[model samples]
Target: MALTVPRLLAARAEAEPAHIAISQGADTLDLAAWQARTQAIAAGLRAAGIRPGERVGLLYGPRDWIAYACSYTGVLAAGAVAVPMSVRSAPAELAYMLEHCDARALVYGPAAKPPDVPVELCWGPERISALPEAEPIPGPRPGDAAQILYTSGTTGRPKGVVAAHANLTHGARLNPPLRALAHSRHFLHAFPIGTNAAQTMLFNALTAHAGMLATARFVPEHFARLIERHAVGTVFVVPAMAIELLRSGALERHDVSSVALFGSTAAALPPTVAAELAAAMPHATLVNYYTSTEAAPTQTSMVFHPARPAALGRAAAGGTLRVCDEAGRPCPAGVVGEVWMRGAGIPRSYLDDPETTRHVFRGGWTRMGDVGYLDAAGYLFLVDREGDVIKSGADKVSTIAVEAALHEHPEIVQAAVLGLPDPVLGMTPVAVLVATRELRLAEVRAFLAARLAGHEQPSRIVHVDELPRNAGGKVVKHRLRELFDAAPDPRT
Candidate 1:
């Protein structure tokens, strides 16, 4: 049934040897070719003394996506846990992840800089390709550990999420497979390697009917041109990329009508941006995919409907969703609470932190760390991150709701709301904006007045060229707070 990734590759290679599995610009790999590379890499790892169940770090840049994909598969085939790391990560961060996972070896690509962390061995594309292809190694069970993915360290050091083979292959073996973008011959995305969103794209390449086409980096004009050039049927992006695509007028310049499905993931899509996307790709289904590194493969996806612009969508992918109170009891419809999800796949945990593991993954449900509410129809609407909620005087404000309101303003190109320490109010909501032109605080306040409650409105405003974002396109709120720290007190 191909329950594990290795088994899936073997099955697909045998079933459709000539089928194109993935491509990056001029580089393409058929199922058979990819399988051969995977086997050779696995043989090399075995020869390097990388044992089963040990962690092996994969360092690769965006342009080396194909090599990274094959290397990751090879690690699994050799029964070793794959640790995917991005070259974009800070050297210290990369070193920490490799050292934390106790990696046996590091496999790197030409464009990647291997971390200085001590490991038994390091192999690059040249050496990896030189290894003789051996027959497939055995003994990887579906229940065994598969990969370790690190979360963006917005608040603290990045934590590794350990996903088992079952988690990655959850729905791969269904009698009637559920293929994403089933109508498309090719799906295109510029997601950075090592992100949860990018991991999903990898799985789609292995299981979906379409070929996965990826760009080395995301340039709005280039992205749009690729869609038009290939007549791409399915597309994916984060909200930041979508914003750029619209702001750069790429949609107007390029013929992107070939795209039938447009998906956004990694963060909640602001209602304003979703509306703009719907307007630009009128025929395409605009979907928002909401999930975390901890609750992956189990997510909720919504097709953009003008009537329910804020809904994240009901649970999909054989998973269940609920909004629960502090004690973990389910909240009634429309009541804001912590969000949690339970998927058919095995529950993931923090790599080595049992205390945090107990706090986040409870009773088979992964706490999403975001505050949200479920509607009567079960659609979820995010309020704010648990840490980002603003406590102003006796009232609480949702940063997400405030940001959504700010995005609707015509002059605002980007907006991030965060709590700033206030002498009188303890903490107050502040708006950091990237605007088309200078806007008076009074004018911005008046604009948000009708959209937000008094307490939800920002007490002060700050202007920036752009909001600082992580690789996955999520705003780094702490960095925004740092900006306010360097400035004169707003209360003054």
Candidate 2:
């Protein structure tokens, strides 16, 4: 029995020593070779003084998935908690994360400009495979902290969620005979390191009947080319990536019929995007998954219901979910409340933050902190984030409601809504849009006048070339507020 991911990986290496386990462009590695490299990195970390229970920082960039995989597993083998930081993060953000986690050693990719830490190792892509091979160290205990993945820090500084060895191993303990992933020879995704989506893809590779194929960065054309070149049967992407693939006209340009399953996660798929994807890939089943970094892999998956495109499906096997009112009581069907869930994959708590840990982690359940409701058929419907709700003079408006309305416009590619200071209303709604053409505030107000209530309508509108996103494709809401607020609002 596999108590951890590295142990399962080791078992696979013994069972299928020569089978190809990973492929990217021209690079490929068989199970035995991959296992040996992971073990070598593990031994290297131990020799470099990575102690058990210590937090080790990881900064592998997008170019090489192999480095991320080997180094991550190596940290577990060494029994140190891995702290994976985004390579895209600013220096200060990176510094804060390392300092907050009390990271002893920073294992970074060549491109990463890590902070001033006690110890640092620069494992360039070329050098990752050449590290001296060494014997395997002791395996991790089930209750031990395996990794620390940071959240978006929307409310405060990014919080690090600590995953136990059992939590990290949940995704790979998959049952065989999956409908979509099992039939595919290769599954393709473009998630960056330091995100659970990327980690889940790697787990799918180990558990399912596919060799994981990945791109260093997400380029729509490049993604299309890979699908055509590899005859990829299954592909998973964020909703933004799917929307890009649709907008780029790459679906029509590339012969991507080999794709049988199109999966999406990180955020709910816009109705327009979901409908277009279904029409574009008629042969494929569109799946939307819902889960957070804290309750990862143990997700709610919906097989794109034509009638309920917005519904985030039912709890996955071995997962439990419920919609609860403020008092923590389960809400009846069709009632909005907080979404709470628990699964073997759910992290134990946020590292070093007992207050936050106590706030969200109750018994074995994790409060998802999102406003949602369950449907009559037991499906979950996510309405808005509790923190993201906008308040007007006399009404509380959901940001999702405004964003959904904006998505209805053909010219609007993406939209984010937030509350702004208003003398008359105390707090008024504002919109930041990524559009194909310049949009005036009057144009937005007129378009949404009939669709939304007067108070719910965006009082200010700002246009941007692109909405900034993290590695997982979630909009960095704070950045939008900072960068777009200063833009001249046509209303003024």
Q: For candidate 2, lDDT tens digit of each residue in 55-152?
A: 88889878767777777887888888888887877778888888888887777776677665555554445565577887888878877898899987
The list of candidate 1 runs beyond 4 A from truth reads 174-178, 489-491
- Candidate 2 — which residues are off by over 4 angstroms? 120-130, 171-180, 483-492
Clashing pairs in 1: none
lDDT by residue for model 1 (118-141), tens = 998888878987888788878489
lDDT of each: 0.89, 0.82
Error of 1 at 107 (Å): 0.4
Displacement of residue 196 (Cα, Å) in model 1 is 0.9
Count of clashing residue pairs in every prediction: 0, 0
| C-alpha lDDT of residue 29 in model 1 | 85
